[model samples]
Target: MYIPLFDIDGTLLKGGGGNQAHKNGGSYAFRTVYGLDDKACWDNIITDGKIDKQIILEVVEKNGISHKKALAKLDEAIDATTSYYLEHSNEGTCIAADGAIELLEELQKQNVPLGLLTGNIEAIGIDKLSKAGLAKYFEFGAFGNLALRRVDLIEIARERAIKLVGLQMTTSKFMIIGDSTLDVKCAKDGNIPVIGVSTAKSSSQELAEAGADLVVESLLQKDDIVKFILD
Candidate 1:
């Protein structure tokens, strides 16, 4: 059976302004942990496809904090950011992408294993999925806190999937479903097939150009998506 590892933010969930909550949490962490009060410092950094620690380090370094200092405070900052997001973002703030749940249901019905490979910290990712009612669909996840680069999560996810399913699945037996070129890049780096869904920031053209094996406008293309995965 094939295992599809989905990206959380854009692939499974969208809108609800929960992202603002994450930004607010990051700013809060900066002020509380690093003593940096510049919200713009946190806001200006591009966070796409990067892990939480990478984002935090970038923000702190941009504000003149040394790399060592940022590393020392990284865990605390991540905790603060997660705490703030969990406290602020509730079910109302997480909206499942169009046809996301249906797609999961169809895949699940086919006995395909579902997992998460996302740049979100574990807690925040779970919170968002729980809010969107997507948490139940995923059996395991490789979260952002586990690595500094998105590509690294691919191997971790594979190992975990092997353990969870008790099967020695090769990279070819796995597929990545996400909405960003970063996701495509991660898959390419790990030698995994990737399907790009243009339901968020990155467009289909960009994802195709990034070398995604398949690109779809959205998960709403359920038949095409399912066929790609099973094939």
Candidate 2:
């Protein structure tokens, strides 16, 4: 049988701050709009309730820096923040939830083919798995940068797995295991079962509400994660 597709943040790697860590904070936004350095811009953003368009225009007009530059800097800052969190969390070490890697290993030994489907960009996702020495476990996978929505990229993963591994697995054989409501929605949109692991922000009940076929609070117990897939 084809193995399951897993999500990275909040699913496999613990403490790798998810979307909240990725959002452009008000301070960061203000910095970009005002062309100010990190400290001064952040100080105003934190104290001010709203960012003024006048301030943005004032900075842009005065600095004579291209608007594109500011925009690019904003994107860069977001990536930098994400990278900082990834580095601090020691994502390179894996540090997955209890039995997370072991469960994948068990499935691997059983000849099940596995893949990854993460919301993280390809480079960041690959580095995390590689550092954890878990990259070899997945011969195929998809990353978030492909599309804005997870469902759009879930299909990408299926197609890649079929082509790269020459496996003719269908939606029925495909499964997604993750820790959030988005995972359930993404899998359902792709017409597959989504196994929700409640080890992160999203609880089992929330996942159920979002349409998870099966929910596991923790996969540390023997055969728990494996049986969910095969059963």
**The candidate that achieves the highest TM-score relative to the unseen native structure:** 1
In the range 1-231, model 2's lDDT, one tens digit per residue, is 446888876777775433333323323544544445644443322111111232332344345556666544544544554455454444124556677778888887778888888766666567666666677788988775455457776678878988999877766788888887877888888888888888876887898999998888876753867877777
- Tens-place lDDT per residue, model 1, 73-116, is 89999999999988888524788999999999999999888989
Model 2 ranges off by over 4 Å = 17-94
Task: Tell me, by lDDT, which candidate is best.
Answer: 1
Error of 2 at 195 (Å): 0.6
Candidate 2 lowest-lDDT run of ten: 45-54
Collision pairs in model 2: none
What C-alpha lDDT do the candidate models reach, one value each? 0.86, 0.65
Model 1 score (lDDT): 0.86
Give the TM-score comparing model 2 with the true structure, all chains together.
0.70
